[model samples]
Target: MDTTNSPSSTDTDDEPRWKIVGPGLLVAATGVGAADLIATLIAGSRYGYTLLWCAILGCIMKIVLVEGAGRWTLATGHTIFEGWSSLGRWTHWYFGPYIVIWGFVYGSAAMAGTGLALAALLGGLSVAWWGILSALLGLTLVWFGHYGLFEKVITAMVALMFVSMVTAAAIAVPNVPDLLRGLVPTIPDGSVVYLLSVAGGVGGTITVAAYGYWLREKGWNTPRFMRVMRIDNRMAYVITGIFVSATLIVGAELFHAADIAVSTGDQGMVDVAEVLRDRYGDIYGTLFLVGFWAAAMSSLLGVWHGVSLMFADFATELRGLPGDHPDAQAGGRYFRAYLLWLTFPPITIIFWGEPVWLILAYGVLGAVFMPFMAVTLLWLLNTSRVPDRWRNRWWTNVALALIALAFAALAVTEIQKAVSGVL
Candidate 1:
């Protein structure tokens, strides 16, 4: 006798569209971080509204890239690592070294970045101490909390960031005409690198690659969730665009209009917060710092959970274990190991600066990853690997191809910048 319906059918029917937007929102908020904000601020200060179009393009490019990643996972029950494995042994060859080296460098940078924001907010502690504290706190939270709790914390932080940035932008009262004019694509003289950086780098990073694993965590393994996943991805990036644009607006109105120069890196954000305080008094500046800390913390928490899942899966595959092995799930041994790797070793960078060779390697590898991801997605999605209905449409192919080309150019530029800096 057939029951009302199978358990799977019942599960599908009960899942609402809105509930599934979690993974996308998590990825978008995590992707922005302090670096993306710094990039946007620099762009706004240098070119005003002239390069605004590039930021929007960046958002679209990320949507296409992330969508491709999510679609592959839902259409195939295999994890993304498994799909990469299907490509060849070369895939593992690239990812193995890349993750290890990149994680070592990035973990430190992320911690220092978060620490800088916290130190700015607190006003008395040294940046290094605050950064060390942040790393330990992030470790404790991720180590003990399950995915559901982690997701909730990230969502709350995202809300804090959005409110802070949007409110700051509103208070700045950007020139309506210039804001509208920025929508037109135009490049100022000697601004090509800034243009390319903004166009290709907005909210796009290794976190985009983490999308598939996040989907698995959210239980969107079946093909039925594909449409919902697409909707979620698109909406998240749209929100990302708004958040980014608000920062740009703040930069244009606050720094550009006053002919002020902010410093480089994450510290520039602190400088801007100080300027805001000096100009608008303590409350406005405090709000901006709060937003800055939220953004940094979101990135920290995200990489802690998301990349740990990725490393655990990689370790499982390397050991010839099944994908569903419990060790690959949250709080598993391998996951905790990577989470610790992301937390503790990086603290040493606070006392001793990053090595020259390490920075060069991080730059070269980081540059190539997006193009690698784009080209691979094009290969995986077009072949017999995915179901016919799930295959990328013609327009999707064009978007991804452009994304690959753009990223390749950006990668070359980044490598050049790294080499030049070393020289």
Candidate 2:
């Protein structure tokens, strides 16, 4: 498949090896979507830099999770799904419905997010229509595009997002004293929920589970590449840290004024873009929206490609196909079906309001997934599933245990909010 200009080639390209863009970069771009941006923005606007440490902590948590995923695949020569199946059939029972329902709802949400930024940047259509268009665009790319091409495009978008937000924050001139104070980790009254969101929500999703697949695609799937995988994972989250913290800095500097009211959710980013127009100039505002669009689109594309690859694998395994089955790879029949699954039907939700029940089910299922992933990884890596040489070290097990507990708490909180919203 189309392999020219693939970032994977950087391994020996003699190009300046700065960040070493690879599966790690893809996971980084995929993990930090619009929701993560809004969470940090809200935290900053409400409490200034007081929650900055949470962003750091969130990244550390994710690093552990992604490392575990990658390690399992390299050590066991099996996909994550295969590892889970060895545990028993219950995993299939839980994962089957969760992936299907989660993809449907998440597809609409992602399209709307990209649409929001697109409509703001270009004024010809409603956010919903723009969202539908974005879905189609994402579908086209992932459906026909090779992994190498996809990686290059994601790298460009991530660069735009990083530059736009960090540059905006720099122009705002952050208060060093306030920022320094934020590192002390004291939670103000009523800051519990926002703190939880920032600490746990930095950059995570089922896409973290897809890290291994990207590793295999990049030809990094062996014990020999363990050191490289660790570096790639660390650098990815380090980049994630900058993306999120720069957004928080933007919130703290631009939206902290008493006159500015920050909207919750991804729309809040659009609101900030308008503020940018007034505060900076048309250039800055347009830049900000373009950055936001890059972010939303990068994330949508990542999920479109990564998670669909995952679904393809899941389907292939269920059909008793070999691990090397063609239908499980990117652009294969199963993968294309999932890409279509993520694209077309969600357009109806974007057009007319769909029923709430399935969406709520999606919410509840999605909420529990972080913990599910964490706990399962803890089990898989600790037991005989992975080789003794590559099993979790003491520190790794502790980290995963703590992550599982933290995610369990966040899942419960998310479920409560989902249920309360319906009531």
Candidate 3:
């Protein structure tokens, strides 16, 4: 079973170590997809740097969550799904339907988002065609590439996103005074939606739970890899924090100063670009849009790979398969099945538009997943299933609890938004 411990770096090796940053980068990259960009840009346009604290808090929460997922894998040599299965049948029950519905809905949205970027880049192609092409590209890449290839591609994409976005922010030159005040952590009046959106949207989704799968893929399965995993996870989210913060800075400097109204959804970023063009000229706006595209595409690739992995795990587990049992890991039948599901099913939404009920179901399911993950990780890591020394620290527990409570509130507000539409 290849139980030999993987060799760690020697003390004398002073060279920059890229291997230390592994699946955590992939997780952070994938989790902080287009929706997160939209949320951050919106917050910047609406509240300027006032909600910058929420974005920072969101990054910290994700670090804790992803760290917990990675820690469980390294400590127990079990996948996150395996950890969840140990929680009992209810975990499966919730995850089973959620994966199915979430994949169907998210696939179309992700493809469309990717397509939007492609269409922007290539003016001739229709958005639908671009979306389909993007989906196929993701499917083909993951179908052929192993973990190392996937990680490399994602790392490059994250770098592209970071440079583009950070450069845009630099050109905008946000106010130091306002940015300083934003660090004070005060939510402005009547900003509940802004706060919840920032907190909830900071690079999170069902795919955050896939961190362990990626960890296993990275050959981090023993207690020895624990330190490396922590370093990897922390670095990934720190990058994510910077990307999000830079977006807030751009928002504060550009939109707040001009009193511009940012549109809703992913298009909000496009509007930000337009404002940048009007104010600073073409170069700044074009560069920001390029960065926006990079952010969206990185996320698309992440979802394409991560959620498919989760579904593949779920499918194999339901049939009583082992982790190394041929059909469970990446490139197995179950994995391809999900790739097909993610690529094909959501196309219907592109043509017909997402139904109100389906959107509602997706929102409801998504709102609870963070809490579900946090609570279950707490249970799994604390139990005898994991080594006592590797279990969560007191601060970890407190952070997880706060994450759960915060998501619970977000879930309630989401439900209210859903119900109000019906009434």
RMSD (Cα, Å) for all candidates, in order, is: 4.3, 4.4, 3.5
True-structure RMSD for candidate 3: 3.5
Q: Candidate 2 residues 1-423, lDDT tens each?
A: 110112244343454445455898888888788888898888889888889888888899988898889888988889999888888989999899998988888899998899999888898999998998898998889888888899999999999999999888887788899888877878889987888788777775788999999998888877766766777888888888988888888888888744466898888998888888887789998999999999899989999999998999999989999778899898799899989899987877877886678867887888888998999998998887777877887788788888898888888888888888777
Clashes of 1: 0
lDDT of 1 by residue, 67-160 (tens): 8888889888888788888899898988988888788888888887888988888868888888778878889999998778888998889888
Model 2 TM-score (2 dp): 0.95
- How many backbone clashes does every candidate have? 0, 0, 0
Off by over 4 Å in 3: 1-17, 421-423
- Compared with the true structure, all predictions reach lDDT values of 0.85, 0.85, 0.81
Give all TM-scores, in the order shown.
Answer: 0.95, 0.95, 0.94
- Residue pairs with clashing backbones, model 2: none
Question: Model 3: per-residue lDDT, tens digit, 283-329?
Answer: 87777777777777777778878888888888888888888887888
Q: By summed lDDT, which 10 consecutive residues of candidate 3 come out lowest? A: 1-10
Residue 227 deviation, candidate 3, in Å?
A: 0.3
